[model samples]
Target: MSIYRKDIYVFDGDRPVKALIRSYTEADFEGLIRIQQESFPPPFSPELWWNEEQLGNHVRLFPEGALCVEIEGELAASMTGMLVNYNPGDPDHSWVEMTDAGYICNHLADGNTLYVVDIGARPAYRKLGLGKWLMLSMYEVVVRLNLQRLLGGGRLPGYDRVADEMSAQDYVQAVIEGKLKDPVLTFLLRCGRTPVRLMADYLDDEESHNYAMLMEWRNPFLPQES
Candidate 1:
């Protein structure tokens, strides 16, 4: 726990980073789509991002808080709030149809869990701590709602386990060699999120090369600021 407490503050790095965390707005939807399109594959359509953006907005309606961050006047990042008791009728809740939806649904069929559904940082400004800042912002929001934990599916690329393909294995090796930034998973760990890879076989289908990992945060509070 103490090891992770230190992870919350800005490290001694140089990137001219300044983050402002706040709620999602109607005006911010398109910008959010732009950010998502830049960071991941099979990116969300404007309509999809718009719907997900609205879902993220639900964090504010609950005792739980949600936030988006603007860095240097650009919509740099967003942290969607999760519902602790996720009954659709309960405040604001969401269930998505993803490539792995069926697998994840059957895998963890019964439960009430809050998840950080959408998290992405702009490409150019990535590797800076801005992403972590956004994550900690979400962490604070979870605690404010007095929620015990958060849940979500994280980095599910086409090749999760089998790195037989040179390109795919190279990518994994790059991560081992410190050449790639596993920002999302790293942030999940720093927040003490435990992730389980679900639907590992989906990688066989190139189109559905989607790999999903479940990230759980048992204690959703940030380390006290000294």
Candidate 2:
């Protein structure tokens, strides 16, 4: 129930560090918590962080979709997701409902869409392409599961800097057009994910103005239906 990728590496300044991306194990519980806390600071409620039960449920529901990364024998990053089915025209769930308030509620195995519930990297590992690596790794899961696409909500961390100057949609459009840089959504866009719409009250982060960008990344290899 683990995927081992040997070729992935991220650089800390000029030092090249190899990272092992694999499925979660019972032993990784503490490491996951530490990294989660480091990646997401305060303002995210305590209930939003991963606990043993929630992590265990994710492993039980979809082991292949639950993955972690290790660098120099230390757990540095992780990504969790679940299978779901929804109409492309209207997605009914927000980040809270889809992830069971960040714990992942119901995972539909027969569903064609792979929902990225959560993902984070250690502070020291930021800007090293680790997040992008993990995201691309999720795409591998989608292909292996024969899913239609990958979907998730991206936090607008840069919103607070210019909220009074523009609307959320305007901010998103600015990011897409390269007029502004959102630490989260811009990177997602660079990774080939498209912003579908703005989601209100998606999470508790005040930095994003309690908003998020609903995004999607289709599997290019999958056949399209007319």
Candidate 3:
């Protein structure tokens, strides 16, 4: 079955550019890396970007979990994920631990949670609806697979500005209260994910002070625990 497909618009320059959302393939590996490069430029370690081996693993392990948006044959955005038996009791986890350093080696086929490894768009495509569409597409996967929820560690990219003034918990509370806006966290919130808790050393992002927020979007159809 096809992962997802839809017509979308990317507000790049003077006009809205037409785009298509669909499951990515092995052929798009280089394009995906380019998207990451543009999304996270220099100062963001190049070694952290998706490599050929990781992309190969993603396609081989869970092809349906890899989705991307393309503009006239150009890959503009992507979101990669895999299933896992999530443990709610232990919510604290680093990106490296969960994602297996982006290779997603721990993916469990029968797991109830679809854990997102990464989601990003090219610089020019940022703030557009592309990211949201990519997220929604993954949510669709949760429904199709009859999973419990979608989970991920989202960066608090705007936290550093107030790091010395308040605690990470306080900062997350501010975002939840709508008193502040974070580049990454705010976007995830807007996409319907509920904040779980603030996680420390989640990533190496200086802007986030290496903090992240564990977020989740529950499957509405999941049966209540009996």
Candidate 4:
């Protein structure tokens, strides 16, 4: 049985001898599913992730150079991120896929930024600097793509009286641990990303309102190539 655990390697002083980051591919489908399912409470469906991993859509993670780590050829940890996209490619007037670029356009004005919709590691692999490594990896992706910034969403369980005193980080944490608050906004701050909006309010009955937190890369001015 393939044990997909602790597959990610952070740039620790020790350096990882047993794990390393690997480019995501179709071959990783089954193992990736197993790892992700075990990582998130409601893991993304295998079919959904497989299609997104390959950009089998006019919108999604298809054009991303995402990376995951494995040990002994077993999927242990993964980071689902993206590179900048000018257009999803319209050789025949094709619609662009909804990757980082689309996510930013949906919230921020047209600009050069890479949005990291999600970045997660298994609980078992926590505190191993995987999160920091993932951030560095994201930085590399941003620089390589000449992206000016990185943006992402911090989803909450909508708005409820229980959240009346909740903070952004609290909401993000809630999503991760099912009891903690959101973490996106705070993590972004630590990653050199800045918050743009922080509004809270009530929602219609039953439906929860997302106290969305929008953040942008510190420097929105990437030097253009001569």
Candidate 5:
């Protein structure tokens, strides 16, 4: 029930690269591992990383939600997500719980929210709009499944530089107001996602101070009530 195929294309420096945005396959294991390692280095610990077995389970559990981008048959970026019944009124959940510490055991087929587990673009392919395209691809999945919203932890890569001067909440607010340009949070905000709250100990990343911005993008295509 995948809404996206491998027909998408994005230009790589005016070269007109033919990119394939599609579901994850066993053959992509090595590529995914390499991308994760390269995209998120030291700050992202080995304990917080996803392995071949965990990623394979995601494909088996929710093939439609697992997406990968290939440029000229080389894996460029990948996004992993799952459907979950999220209660907006409830407190923000930690990354460990949402992604099951990268095991992805929280996926629920009949859930109303699409929880984005992880999304990363290889260092070489950065700024090619691959991340945005992958997100839009997931948005398509949301519309196709009639999900309520898309949820994930938005990393604050620019926080460490300013943490001594303000709180995480204040940093997020500044980013939203365009006063600050956080590498991750700012991009998510630009993509129409809203910061719900600042989550402490969300992950093991020292760059983010183990903090993450709980973000959500409500689906505009949800059916109206009668």
Candidate 6:
């Protein structure tokens, strides 16, 4: 069941098209796979694409965290996540380990953090504010559930070109300072996520040089700890 639903609009040239944001259902499996393929095209590892087992796990384990935006019954964007009792003291962890190899088998029912495993939009839907809406919807979940924060590994797709010119830490700092613009990191930052640290070897993507920035978006409704 979709616990949340919203009607949104996106533009195709000057015409506004209706879109729907809601939790994912088993019916959305094929559309989800298409979005994954479009978002991560050839030259990117096909092995990393969403598999039936992984999608089934998401639908079965944490349906609320599996969400998508649809335009005329066609999926335009999607995001998936799960809850975890995050450990800040030992913050370094691979994407595989954190997401249970994309199965989300380790999802914690009482976890205080919403861990974003993956998010992407079809190329045609980019910059339509669909991503932001999906992200904000997740934030709403954080507030509604009284979670501590939303966490994700922000990719640095723009880092590879400058990998020889600067370290990953310097590259991330530059992006945070607006000296550089990373497709993924910039989008995450604009969505109110702040860099927690530079996480190395987080993935096998050549574009990000296998590094991802750990990002955090704290719930303002939650009281601060001393």
For candidate 5, the per-residue lDDT at 163 reads 91
- Sort all candidates by lDDT, best to worst: 6, 3, 5, 2, 1, 4
> Best-fitting candidate, measured by TM-score?
6
Q: Please give the lDDT score for candidate 5.
A: 0.85
Model 4, 1-226: lDDT tens per residue? 1111224444436666466665566666566556655654532223323333332221233334355665555666665544443322212111123342223223232336565644556665654555656666666666655666565544343434455676545655454454533344445556665555444431111223535554555333465332
Off by over 4 Å in 4: 1-17, 42-64, 82-111, 156-162, 166-182, 199-209, 218-226
lDDT of 3 at 224: 44
Tens digit of per-residue lDDT, candidate 2, span 1-226: 5554545768878888788888888789999999889988877666678889988888788888888888889888899899888667775567878877656667887989988889899988776778888889899888887888999989998999999999999999999999999999988988889877898988888899989998988888888644
Residue 126 deviation, candidate 3, in Å? Answer: 2.0
- In candidate 3, which residue ranges exceed 4 Å CA deviation? 1-3, 9-16, 224-226
- TM-scores, all models, native as reference: 0.61, 0.94, 0.93, 0.57, 0.94, 0.95
Candidate 6 lDDT tens digits, 10-68? 77778888989998888889999999999999657788899989999998898879989
RMSD of 3: 2.0
Following a full C-alpha superposition, what root-mean-square deviation does model 2 have from the true structure?
A: 1.7
Better of 1 and 6 by TM-score: 6
lDDT of 1 by residue, 1-226 (tens): 0001112223336534555666666567677767767765453333334354354334324313345667656776665544534432333212353312211222222234556656777777666656667666666545644555566665534343444644543553454465654544445566566644343432223432454445666543544211
Model 5 stretches with alpha carbons more than 4 Å out? 1-3, 223-226
A best-first ranking of the candidates according to their TM-score comes to 6, 5, 2, 3, 1, 4
Candidate 1: residue 29 lDDT (0-100): 68
Deviation from native of the Cα of residue 75 in model 4, angstroms: 2.0
> Residue 181 in model 3: shift from native, Å?
0.5
Cα lDDT for residue 45, model 4?
29
